[model samples]
Target: MSNPYAPPDPASRPPKQREHTGPDAPSPADGGPGPGKAPGRQGRAGRPERPKPTPEQLASVSRSVLHFGLFMLAAVLTMQVDLPWHLMSLAFAIGAVVVGVRALVRVFKEQIRGGIVVLLVFGLMLSGMLVVTTLGSLAVWNEQMERQECLRSAITVSAQDRCERIYQEAIEDRFGTIPGG
Candidate 1:
């Protein structure tokens, strides 16, 4: 007795044939492989169609890169100068903000890694700006303190003490304090 689920012998069935009558029909005239299966299908159901990046994405990426480079250049110029011309530092700060914002826009446009780099760099630059600005203010206040010595000699004790307190507070504001002192 034969099993009910036994496979049919090849001799008992006709040869298989390709059908070209439906939506999955092959374009044989274009030299494709055959019906239903194309040569490009490497695995299950072919790769999903991905939307290409828009021109806006490309522009944002380029804009952010340019502004980030500008920020770096401005940072070097500001840090190495003899005089504390804060204009350059301010420009660097502005550049950092611009680059970071542009990068954020790009992040929504499928450029995650690039956007993150821009944001991190901007954060570093802003932190450096805080330190540098504080140092510059300290220098300016120190000069005023030196110039005000003539007033200290002429003023009342109370006025002199007030002036001294102002200088002390300025120093503390710039550099918090030594560990113990």
Candidate 2:
């Protein structure tokens, strides 16, 4: 009887080869490099480098910058307007708290230097906003006070004039003072 336990003959066995081809081939450095070249040199050359800064990324950056610039401009305009000092301070404090929290989160994520830079920038922005708002509020308050004082003075003068006229009429009626006619 034939040897039942013997291994199959090499000539009769299927050729050793990968099942797939083309782009399906693994990269040279990682695995079998098929379609184009030998596995050793496939990833080393011939492939075009990827383009930098995709359009979406560029647009995102532009939008972020525009938003930041607008925010800064608004803050500057607020400085010229009448904002309350206490309210401004409160808003700045809130902003600072938010920035601190974000920075802490970044730090926890192993971005310590980035967190510090962000914290510094946010702190500066908050401070600037507070100052602008505070100054605006003070200016508005002063203007209101001046207007009130002017109104008060005008009322006082009018009241005094009316009092003088009434007193004159009473004297004329009491003493029959039509002598000038």
Candidate 3:
């Protein structure tokens, strides 16, 4: 017995019956145009021809994709917890926003349909991240600067220790101790 899940053998099957019998019905031999398809719609392989995208649409899509990648990179960078890297993350977020806006504008002007939703969503998300990072960076700015200056002038390990102590004190003073401690 044949396996129930296996495909049927084409050679043993009867020929397909055409649904339409009129004179205008598509010919099976030549794979003539089907219903709703005009003769001119077929391309080289009898498939419908698709319209090519314009250069503007290509640019818009590329920019939108780039912004998405940049935004993700910024989010990862922000988690590094280093001041310089946080600044770099801020820069990446800013660049993402700029690229996203350009993509949105191009998509709107050219009437491209593909990347508008991506641009809008990532643009808003990147903006919120940018503001949050900027504020966080500002809050730590003075402490970081003082620590850096202190460490820069230190010729010995003890002075560097002093800089770290000051930074810790400033942070604890501003943020208070851990709840359980």
Candidate 4:
């Protein structure tokens, strides 16, 4: 009666232990073999490989924030100063153009599909901002210009009135009577 699960020849069983004698294997001083170099020399060997953000990635984030912030700040400040809104809006548009170009360059350099999508979206947003700022500034400038024109007209009318009174007085003195209109 033999057990079904038993080995056919128990006397022929292989040895349980195997010896490691490779140069890559860990020395006795550093415990058994493992991934990477020995513990004490790990620091001197430089840091282990790690995933890190590339320069393009860092530039992408930094530039995006900077352009956006600059646009907003310019928009707000334009309202407080007496400078022409058209000029402020033009500056904003130029800034957006610069950001768009930078984004395009980064997309090409990084060659990342996701990054490209993000940059494109940002470009669209910046473009829209440019348009809005430009239009808004134009409107403000037109309004201010109209007001200035109105003030100039008023000043001209007043100056004409004063000149007419002086001319009447000079004519009366020359003729020894009031000048008739």
Candidate 5:
């Protein structure tokens, strides 16, 4: 009448293999909770635990974070076409590249496994931002300077408005119609 698939009765098991009876006892598959079990380690076999990262390795990973932050800042700044924004974006992009280089060096020297690929991606992004911002600024340098000067000297709303119109004309002349309509 007993089910054949049911587990064998613990009472009939050998003394060493008997499942311990307690709320805190582990399952039989885990070798139970008693002298039969190896404490402080799992019975399941697989890869051994990995070693903790040294301070230098951790610092290498941290550099990636700094690189990512600088890259993000540069990306945001690059969206603006103004002269100062272009300069600032270029600066941030350069800083990101420097940080990425340091991160890569540390990763190689310390033999860390992660963060290198991400740093390379960030490096490419920063490079693109740098090139775009630099070329864009160079292309509009004179017009940007004139617009900045006019805005700086203008004291009235009408003069400030006139500065915008002049800037529009300058841009139109440079690129044959301003972008974004």
Candidate 6:
């Protein structure tokens, strides 16, 4: 019975070459790590061990997180509240620029992957959502205010009821009609 784990015939096996042996042993010739060379003595696949990033990369990554956070906050506020669209857009733009610049600088300095472009693309996509949300919120607020103005001039209960229904219908048309209404 053949031993599955056994080396295929010792005579057929190439003799094990010791580290740094004969003239055929690797040298820095031809601009590459030659055969039989372990780039880091114990590193896998003869690859030189990677060095850890400097404090510069760490600091820049932190700043990028902060800028991204600002963009998220602005996006939420613009969508939920009645704030001016321009103000929110300005905040979003600044956040995108700051984060992108920091990530790009780090990319060039450190030569890393998934840098500036990813963050910028995310920011722009959310910025577009913010615009749509702001328009929706503005329509809701306007409808409410118009109802209030109409009710103020209304002399009877029926007039006030009519004013409320008109505003409600207008809001429902712009958005979808509320469930259970």
Q: Top TM-score: which candidate number? A: 5
- Of 2 and 4, the candidate ranking higher by lDDT: 4
Q: What is the lDDT of residue 121 in candidate 5?
A: 65
For TM-score, candidate 3 versus 6, the one ahead is: 3
The deviation in Å at residue 18 for candidate 5 is 18
Cα error, residue 157 of model 2, in Å, equals 22
Cα lDDT for residue 57, candidate 2: 55
Q: Write the per-residue lDDT of candidate 1 for residues 1-181, one digit (tens) a residue.
A: 8887988777887666555556664465544445565354433344433455677776767677667667766766675543346446656766666666656566666644544665556665674665467466546755455436635464688777777777666677767876776
Full candidate order by lDDT, most accurate first: 3, 5, 6, 1, 4, 2
Q: Model 5: per-residue lDDT, tens digit, 1-181?
A: 9998999898895555454557777664555434655443443453333455788668767767666666766656674766766676776666666776666776666656755566566666767667676767678889888998999899999999999999989888878975579
Off by over 4 Å in 4: 1-61, 76-86, 113-116, 119-123, 132-142, 147-181
* Residues 1-181, model 2: lDDT tens digits: 7697998787897667554556655654555554545444433365633335556655554454344444444444544433342444545444544544444454444323444456457755665556565655554554444444455455577765665565456555655687774
Root-mean-square deviation of candidate 3? 12.2
Give per-residue CA lDDT, model 6, range 141-181, as digits (tens). 76866776798799999999999889879888888888898
| CA lDDT of each prediction against the hidden true structure | 0.60, 0.51, 0.70, 0.58, 0.69, 0.64
lDDT of 3 at 80: 64
Candidate 1 local distance difference test against the native: 0.60
Give per-model TM-scores. 0.41, 0.28, 0.44, 0.36, 0.50, 0.43
Residue 104 lDDT in candidate 2: 45
Kindly give the stretch of ten consecutive residues in candidate 6 with the minimal lDDT sum: 78-87
TM-score of 1: 0.41
**Where does candidate 5 have its weakest 10-residue lDDT segment?**
40-49
Which clashing pairs does model 4 show?
none
Question: Candidate 5 regions off by >4 Å?
Answer: 1-52, 67-92, 101-127, 178-180
Better of 3 and 5 by TM-score: 5
